[model samples]
Structure formats: structure tokens, C-alpha cells
Target: MAFLALQKDGTQRAWAAEHLWPDCTPYRAAGNLRSALCHARRACATPVVETIGQSLRLAPTVRVDLHDAYRAGDEVTAGLSPPPGTENGLIEALRQDLLPEWPEDWLVIEREQWDQLRLHVLETLAQQLQATHRFVPALQVALAAVGIDPVRETAHRIVMEVHIAEGNVASAYKCYQNYKDMLERELSISPSQRMRELVEELMPR
Candidate 1:
């Protein structure tokens, strides 16, 4: 079901069976796929999964939350306002991992892809909010990105920039110090020169 959902163009039953039950024999995997398909049909009140010839996909009318998030991120990157109520909603949505507790090889790549996309969108949204003096939500959005990947320099940079925008130089400096320490502790590295320059600009001559 997830395999079909993730694919925009749908997938062949043979291909999906091979990937989903890679450890099983071809006959066993095909049997498993058929059983799973039956369960999927029985679990839904309306048809969520659709079959076309030998390919499977989510029905066109089904709403995928991940696809919605991707669209919201696209709107942010394209310099468009997200639909009503989605500004803060996007922040909350990006804060979640795409099935973090799911332990499957196929899921890992999708999860990582979502993580990267959300981080980029969060940072961009934070910058947009900051440019318009929406400092509180800017900070919230930036901090959500930081929470996802603490060592992401861009997210921390946006965090510092948000503080600096509101004349909270002390808070910005503290954020820089924490980020610097985290980098050292986690990756045995220092914050990049760009990050240093951002903080250094706040210091008096």
C-alpha cells in the first residue's frame, strides 16, 4: 500500500512485489502482494487503492499528507503564500518525521528525502517570515528546522538572523555558541566562516 502511495505514476505488480518482499521467492512475494492488496481493499470504506492492468496506485481522489506537504514546500520556495492557515500549520507539519519509527529499507530513502525537503522549506519559510517582521513565527519555523537537524548550518544561521532581526543580539550570540559547541561535539568541527561572520557582525569594533 505504501509502495503504491509513494509512486506518482504507480508501479507494476512485479516490481512492487520484488521490492516489498525482496527476501522472499518470486512466487511467495507475488502471493504476499495479492494478500496485502485484498487486506487494503477490505480496510477502506471507499476505494483508496486502484488497479490498472498490471499496475497499482492510490486512487486519484485520495489525499496524501506527504504530497500536501511537498506542495506546501513548493509554494514556499516559489515565493507564494501557502493556502490559508497553512503558515503555522506547515511549521507543525514539518516538525514530524515521515514515519520515523518505521523500520524498512524502502522507507528509509523516502524518510530522508522528506527530511531534507522539510528542512529546506522550514528555513525558507523562516526567512520569509523574518523579512516581513513576523519574528515569532520566523523563530518557530527556524527552530523546527534546527530541531530536525541540529548540525544544519543554514537552519542555525536563520535562527541567529531571526534573533538579530528583533534586536536580541544576546540571544543570537547564545544561539551561535550553542551551535558552535554542538558542531564540535558531534562532528569535531567548527561552524563555517559564514556562520562566524554572521555572529561577528554583531560585535563592536
Candidate 2:
């Protein structure tokens, strides 16, 4: 179901079955898919999955949280605020990983895709908030990105930017030093020249 949702065009039933049940024989996989589809249909009050002639897809009417988060991310990336009433949950939505509890092998790529997408979106959203002078939420969102990937230089950079925007020079410098040390300890490498330059501007000559 999630695989189908990720695909722009719904996938062929055979392809989905094969991907979802890679270890099973094709015949068994197809049977498993059918059963799962039926179960999904019955479990939902409204349709969650829909079948066409030879393909299956998430129902057009289904409201998926990841999809909503992607739309919100796109809005912020485009410099537009998310629609009214969505502000409260935007951070939480961005914090989520795609189906973390599901241990299916097929989910690996999907999870990575969402992880990268959400990280980009979160960083962008935080920058947008900072640019608008919404410092509190900006720092919160930036820190959320850092929490997701501690070694991600971009996320750390944004954290520093948020601190600087709030007139917290000491905090910003501390953040840079901490990240610099983390990179050395974790990756045995130093921060990039771009990061160093950002921090250099913060230093008094």
C-alpha cells in the first residue's frame, strides 16, 4: 500500500506482489496480495486501496500523512506558508519516518526516500521560519532536523543560523564548535569550508 502511494503512477499488481513478497513464489505472492487487499478494504471504513484492471493503488480519497507533509514541505520550500490549521502538526509530521515499525525488506528504499525528503523539507522550513523572524519555532524545527541526523552538516548549519538570527552569538559559536568536534569524532573529518566560513563571520576579528 505504501509502495503504491509512493509511486506517482500506480504500479502493476504483479510488480507490487513481487516486490512486497520477494521471497515467496509468484503464485503465492499474488494470493497474499489479494488477501491483504481484501483485508485492507474491510479494515477501513472507507476505501483505502482501489483496484483497476491490472493495477492497484491507494484510493484517491485517502488522506495520507506523508503526502500531507510533502505538500506542506513544498509550500514552505516555495516560500509560502502552509494552509491554515496545519501549523501545529507540521513539525510532528516532518519528524516521522515512513512506516518505522514495518520491517519489510521492500520498505528500505521508501524509508530512505522519505528520510531525505523530510530532512530537506525540515531544514527548508526552519530557514523559512527564521527568515520570517519566527525564531522560536525556527529553532525548534532546526533542532528537530539535527535530532534526526546528528552528523548532517546542513542541519547543524541551520541550527547555528537560527541561533545567530536570535542574537545568540555565544550559542551559535558553541553549536559550531560542537558540530566541528562531532564531525572529527564520528567521521574523522572536519567541517566543510562553507561551514567554516559561516562560523568565521561570527568570530570577532
Candidate 3:
């Protein structure tokens, strides 16, 4: 399924066959590709590969995270405001990965591009939602952005501040804890002192 997402539309299956089985006979490679693609579809529960005169595309119905991220990003660039509460969904809809467990291969390059676009668009949505005083929705978007890219400290802080402002100290602390744990466990690092200090402060009742 993921192959369809990563592959360029209209590429000859022979191109894919060659890559998948570099050492094998071209006939064998082409046969393997067909089998692999069929298995991929069943496993992912989507028809990710479509054939149109020896060319392929991801299934038309399979909405990819990268695609949604790009579309949402375009909408924002065109000054289209997202419906309130939908901003976070938009961010979440732009899933952190198209197929996270897929083996690391040439697709890493495409993954990196998707990663960048998803973060950029989600962060933009977070900021826009915040400006409109849709604090809960904004917080969700910000949190999603941070999840997709934990290095985005600004997005994390924004979620914290929004929660505190809304008098949801528990939620604010949970956000802090989750992010703090992720960094510490995954990267062997701690949250910034500024983040630590902010979480201790109380919100107005």
C-alpha cells in the first residue's frame, strides 16, 4: 500500500520490478512485484496500487496523510480559515507517517518531505486557531504538531499556555509530562527550564 504512496504516478511496473529485485531476472522481478502488491493491499485494507496501462497510482480512495497535509497547507496559504475544532483533526489527519513501520529504504527521502509539510501546515493551523480564541482546538493542533516534530518546542509551549489560560491546569501538566517523557526517554534529554517553570504556575480560577 505504501509503495503506491511513495511511487510516482504513471511509472512503468518494470521500473519498480527492477528495483525490487536487482539481482534476479527481470521476469522474476516483475512477477514478484505483482504478488507483493497484492499482499500489500490486503494487509493495509486498501487497494493502494492501481493499474492503468502499465502505470500505477495509489488507490484513489486511500487518502494519504501527506496528501491531506499538502491540501490543508494550500488552504491556509490561500487564506481559508478552518472550521473551529477541526484544526486539530486536520493536524491529526496529517498523520505522523503514511506507513511508519515500513522498512527504511529510498522512501526515507519522501518521508522527510512529508514530515516537513505536515509539521508546517499543522503549526500554521495551530497558530490560526489560537488567534481566533479557539483555545481547545488550538491546543490539540499544537500538540499534534509537537508530536510530529518534538523539536518544535514553540508548539509545545503554545499548547501549555492555552491550557493554562483556559483554567485546565491538569491538561496543561499532562501535556508537559507527555512531551517531557518523550524527549527524555527517546533522546535522553530533559525539558527546558522555561517549560518546567511554566507548568508549576497556577491558572486563574
| Global lDDT of model 1 | 0.88
Model 3: CA > 4 A from native: 19-28, 34-54, 58-66, 83-88, 153-205
Clashes of each: 0, 0, 0
Write down the lDDT that model 3 would get.
0.74
TM-score leaderboard ranking: 1, 2, 3
Please report the candidate that would top lDDT against the real structure. Answer: 1
The digit string of per-residue lDDT tens for model 3 on 114-188 reads: 777777777777777777788877877777777787766777888888887787889888888888888888888
lDDT of 1 by residue, 1-205 (tens): 6677788778999999998998999999999999999998999999988889998999999878878888889888888877777677777788888777778788878888889999989888899889999999899889989889888899999999999999999999999999999889988999999999998999998
RMSD to the true structure for each prediction, in A, is: 1.4, 1.9, 6.0
Model 1: per-residue Cα lDDT at residue 194? 93
Name model 2 segments beyond 4 Å from true: 41-47
- List, residue by residue over 73-188, the lDDT tens digit for candidate 2: 88877778777787769878888777789898888988887778778888888887888899899888888888888999998998898888888999999999999898899889
Poorest lDDT segment (10 consecutive residues) of candidate 3: 1-10
User: By summed lDDT, which 10 consecutive residues of candidate 2 come out lowest?
Assistant: 1-10
